[model samples]
Target: MAKNNGDGKLHVAMLPWLAFGHLIPYLELAKLMATKGHKISFISTPKNIHRLPPIPKTLTPFINFIKIDLPKVKDLPENAESTKDLPFNKVKYLKIANDGLQKPIQDFLKTSSPNWIIYDFATYWLGSLASELGIRTAFFSVFPAVMLGFLGPPNVLIHGDPDNNDNDNTIIIKRPKWVSFETQVRPSLYQLTRWGHYNSDGENMSDVYRLGATVDGCDAVFVRSSFEFEPDWLNLVKRLYKKPVIPVGFLPSTSDTKDDDININNNDSSWLVTKQWLDKQEKGSVVYIAFGSEAKPSQYELTQLALGIELCGLPFYWVLIDQRGASDEEVIKLPIGFEERMCGRGVVCREWAPQFKILSHDSVGGLLIHSGMSSVIQGFQLGKPLVLLPFSAEQDLNATYLVEKKLACMVPRDVDGSFEPESLADSLSLVIVKEEGNMYRDKAKEMMSLFGNRDIQDQCLDELLHFLSTSIK
Candidate 1:
């Protein structure tokens, strides 16, 4: 067994996928563990580590950042550490490069000999490799517990090779036979046909197999969710996996931030302008619209969104992101003369807006998002009702769960498999403005007590710490 510090404090290491959504939560969890007087070693590419948000002065002592260089691959872009830096077509090469970290990580295990290692799905090899050196491992999932339940057991993950084309869409389109309870979440036929092969272009091992290997080799599964929110799903995961399912809390990005920082030290120029505009609006009147960093709409869909927001006629603030390679001239194209026509009524800022501040503002009443888990958690913390347009299968699962809970309204898609401006307008009106939206608004407000409560968040972390302290190899 890996040795500990002998004070019930363990030395834990963290490794997550190369995406901001994954990295931020892993770092937050690290800070939480470090706060409990445990040691942390956060490993990532040098660039990704440098790009993370500034670490707090107090927690810096306990959190140690270990930067390693990823072995260069054939087509990977220069200094492309995170998903945000690369286009979709090039992401396959990035995965190839990510697999190259096995050697250095093996070296880390040999020298540091941490008591335990918490890892993401992508590093499937780490579990077995760490086990050889007598170290314990846990799978730190950023997805919801229900999704983990949906992925089913280790046998399905291992035996079901994503690259195997026995029955193209027939097998995956249907829900797993293992799911005994009545659940509404499943990957759509279109999503499965399009993105199903675990996004394998030429990679040897698919993402699903990676997840399976990670779970099979790990001692426990640490999910980023709460038992209070989804007890049925949590229980299902436990029964199916037949292993310890530890809910590591929602790990809200705003947990450690002081209340004063929201209003005082948040001096980003982009936020200052946004605050000024929001300050003038009536309380709970504006709609906040943003698709997280990774989920971007096609240009045609962007036009539809522009028209839809215009049709809704509600005062709105839109943050339009220009993808990594887009130049100034390639700014998101709205309908001709769209901004001029909607001046004073709506503003589209291409710059980064402070999302937490915007969602928490009294002037904001609702949020329109792509159902990304991190974004959903942030919005719920401030009790903002959601209008969901999920872009991926995982997002679809989250949207289904929220709709079942009566906390969100889904924008209907056309037979052509694309959403229309009219559907967008109607959905936004129903969730943010119309009289019928009050129920959703009320339910979202009720969730604030669960998502925003720090004591509950700390309690979850305490449970995690307790598990690690007691469960020795």
Candidate 2:
């Protein structure tokens, strides 16, 4: 329970999805609100809450961690509370378990009497539940604004047109009449089929419907984007959703300071070792490669990526999380003599590495990654040019935006969503080794000023606070 300041300060309950990608941004927003003298109840399952980055000691007074047990489902594995714990095929089971949280969450809202509930797409039921309890609800989207615009109106997304026959072969997205800008964010047939399968729970509502209902039912929509980056797309979302669409600027971690300011001794030995390796590399010569937590690359794809990295012949640091069922000895089977051949040029870390620390390193000039929004923001914040190898639909859309904006280069992929080693090597070279790469480097640097602007982010926070205050009253 939050202690009210007696100054009409709002108490906000933050309810994000099971995925860390979604939970982290919600937690960042909660921290921002807490900094503004608001009370925050950061709600999540026990395991998910346990995995969150440490909250600053200063914020402990204003923020409370409320854990609710995740309901068990028959198909979901034990202790699998988030997307990172499961393969892509098992993600739907996580969502099914998430739906079970509604009753416990509703019970909390009834007793807590918070002024507002900030929720994610999967928790659409929270909107109506909050409303029933006389609480305001806001949908905080961790995705880019362009994705919502591309998805079109709630009605359209819920009931897509039967006449439309768009498939994977289409290079350009079929834009709605309201969307004035040209979009190259095309979803492949394979990705769409996977999406369909994920949503094919018998008689249960699809993710699109749930998301649409959440947006339609909420008081306002908050996106983890900046107005400067996607003005047209953001404007289109406002028109399509017919709600107050607020851009909260990329919700970067406030603790992200320069390496010099950080106490290296406080970091673990692995981080120190990685940093030492990075320190040995020349400035702007190393490529930092990570595909985020959720993307599980097939062994074939992993091998292709390894070969591509070798082909590029550049100093690289690759973070590869071990396969779920792989043995310790067979965790990462690289090409024979590959490590020996590339000694001093590449390092493959088979465990979690501090991504922000690596990204902010002076030696890292380029990023090879799946275009998750958090990764995208982190990459742009440090002005690192990108080599995008998107592994999912949202990532593909993000990659398209980066390519269209001239901030990154996307590796050419087959219609089946597979990429050849040669293509990956070429894209990496184009972004890192080629003379023309400077344009991307310059663009990334230019955008850093806007994307990483703390002042603008504070202003956005002010706007959000003002909205919550005025609307709640």
Candidate 3:
């Protein structure tokens, strides 16, 4: 076991992608590193920083937040500091805005001279700046190793442009030349050829470019995963990137269970009501449905999801937040009289609720989630079964990997990736009620030792810290 290296206190500057999914894990990692007595210069936009859960008092002294202004771009919405504020398609403008921070960030590095600067895929240009300043850099991937494996090496991501398909999208849909595993973990036909990679319109800031360049340039790569899971992919990334590939563990919350309330305000009425309703349900009976803060199902999908849960006929707690970032008047409308028909079998909250508290409750038998890494870990933390409804490519990757592991059941979608109510209903019932789903529940429970183990996570952190603490860095 790698012990925390207290002999050398290293400084690590963290800059994750502007999305909440990435930001939260990076912050969790910051907290873990801080516990080793290292200093952290955590950077993000002002609004995102304001929205993040409060840093614990004990770690406050070790972490310093650096907020940079997100430059105004032509198409970006007002106050759209993070991906949560805009639809995924409009996020191209946000990347253009993120690039505007290059100047200020460069200035900070020159002044602080941190031992190592860690960054996400969005900052493809960051490695050059770090190299010039004589500082080491690490590409701290907030994504899982399986997705990166499907992405292949740097050259494949860059030249195999989905639009400029070299072989009629055949190359993408098929498993890469490298992956030796015989599994159904590759991207879908639609994901590969049709609705391919996410890209920004204005500049050379397409996701393919950013991802390829970031991996190609970084000194090393660190994944937010564990050796116990995706072992092949974890080791494959080393051969693919030709760099030090280290698993940062599952990043289970190192904080105590009571600390879940830190993100919730004392006057939070939404949590209060949600908790009261959960108290009424039978233990291990309620399906907790939430697509996360950033993903808002379209009216059609929303209707399908809502009606699907209703069709499942199980007690459920659903937290509904429309990510359209619309005005209050444009509130999410469920199917006409949908709630009335449910007759109190389900509870829906339009406002924010403490997700951790709900997942930890006895009432939550299984989770209906977006398959984001953080949510997946949370479900695994409590040894609960999962019903996955993925919205993006990354989500697809996570969901597919979990399904391959027999720990989750992805809501079956059409070849075009659109899901119907019937499919959603059947998937939920199979996971939460049917005996066939017991394997998923049992597998999730078995994984609790590895995924929820903070000691294992701490040891992974120690190894990474040891590398950062070396004099050469």
lDDT by candidate, in order shown? 0.81, 0.80, 0.81
Name the candidate, 2 or 3, with the larger lDDT value. 3
lDDT per residue for candidate 2 within 263-289, as digits (tens), equals 213344687888889999999889888
Among all windows of ten consecutive residues in candidate 1, which has the lowest summed lDDT?
A: 258-267
Global lDDT for candidate 1? 0.81
Estimated TM-score for each candidate: 0.93, 0.92, 0.93
Q: For every model in order, what is the number of clashing pairs?
A: 0, 0, 0
lDDT-based ranking? 1, 3, 2
lDDT of 3 by residue, 33-103 (tens): 99888989999998888777877788999999999998888878899887767776777788889988899
Candidate 1 wrong stretches, greater than 4 Å: 161-165, 168-171, 255-267, 325-332
Ranking by TM-score: 1, 3, 2
TM-score of 2: 0.92
